[model samples]
Target: MALWIYRRLPGAGAAPRPVHLAHRIGGAVLLVLSLPIAYHCITAYGVQMDSARVALHSLAGCFFYGAFAAKVLIVRSRHLPGWALPLAGGTLVTLIAILWSSAALWQLAQP
Candidate 1:
């Protein structure tokens, strides 16, 4: 996927490309880093969903989505390949999950 993105981009034609092995390893690392945070978000504050908590969660969600957007833009501008489709799909799923969970939490937090 990353390769596809890299191939399609323009400026990325000259950028120092990370080796495939390194890319996979880096992806694994990112997955590892995200797991605990996801677990905590779902298990801990997920149940409460109060306005305050939802506000914070929304902020975090914004950050996550924003970063994804920024990364996509950077890769696109650099004419580099990336795991575009999968990353986009994953981001969509994450957004939906968070929004749904937040709604539930908000209901729970309501008087």
Candidate 2:
């Protein structure tokens, strides 16, 4: 749906934009906020057994990830500056690493 909207919108399909430094910084902040919540959810896994808490944290993390992806798209569209791409990529990679590590730890802790 979002891809369709972007394609339909004027100027959105033209070219890949670079991400701005500020936008990259914002993405980093979002990634930081999401990491802890994601870690908590992963660490808890089946141990906590609190569906509500897990759901809320997962939703929040999803929102943060969505924002991060949007920033990446904006950067890719050349709307942002070129220098920030590395930062954006680093932030995304770190988020994935943290999520994976936390999940692995959680699994090890279980049973």
Candidate 3:
């Protein structure tokens, strides 16, 4: 759907049936995956930037939550311009990839 939205511009193509399903399911997954990590981060350090990794992770987490909320609004609200939903969804996805790369993959590479 993101690709389609970009290719078509102005969200001209109707999202396929599966795109709706994927958006809903993927959104749920992202929400579930984010919660505990967010809880741990906020409880453990309270959004400190004492180190580069911690800072980036904390900032990215903030952006992730913001994007998540925006995406949900995009899904629910009809008043937004057509390009908004896909653009929001894509931003969320790109942020997730960056977070995963910087945090998860970085940890795996450490030892």
- Candidate 2, residues 85-105, lDDT tens digits: the string is 556656656655655554556
lDDT of each: 0.60, 0.56, 0.79
Q: lDDT tens digits, residues 1-111, model 1?
A: 454444655655633445555765775686568768667776765544357757756565555656556654654464545465557646746765676576666778889
In TM-score terms, candidate 3 sits at 0.73
Q: Which candidate do you rate higher for TM-score, 1 or 2?
A: 1
- Weakest ten-residue segment in model 1 by summed lDDT: 12-21
| Candidate order by decreasing TM-score | 3, 1, 2
- Top lDDT: which candidate number? 3
Question: Which digits, one per residue and each the tens of the lDDT, describe model 3 over residues 1-111?
Answer: 456534564646676778767866876996998799889978987887888877877788889899988888887899989889878878887888878887889999996
RMSD in order of candidates: 10.5, 11.6, 3.8
lDDT of 1: 0.60
After superposing candidate 3 on the true structure, give the runs of residues whose Cα lies further than 4 Å from its correct spot: 1-19
Error of 1 at 50 (Å): 2.6
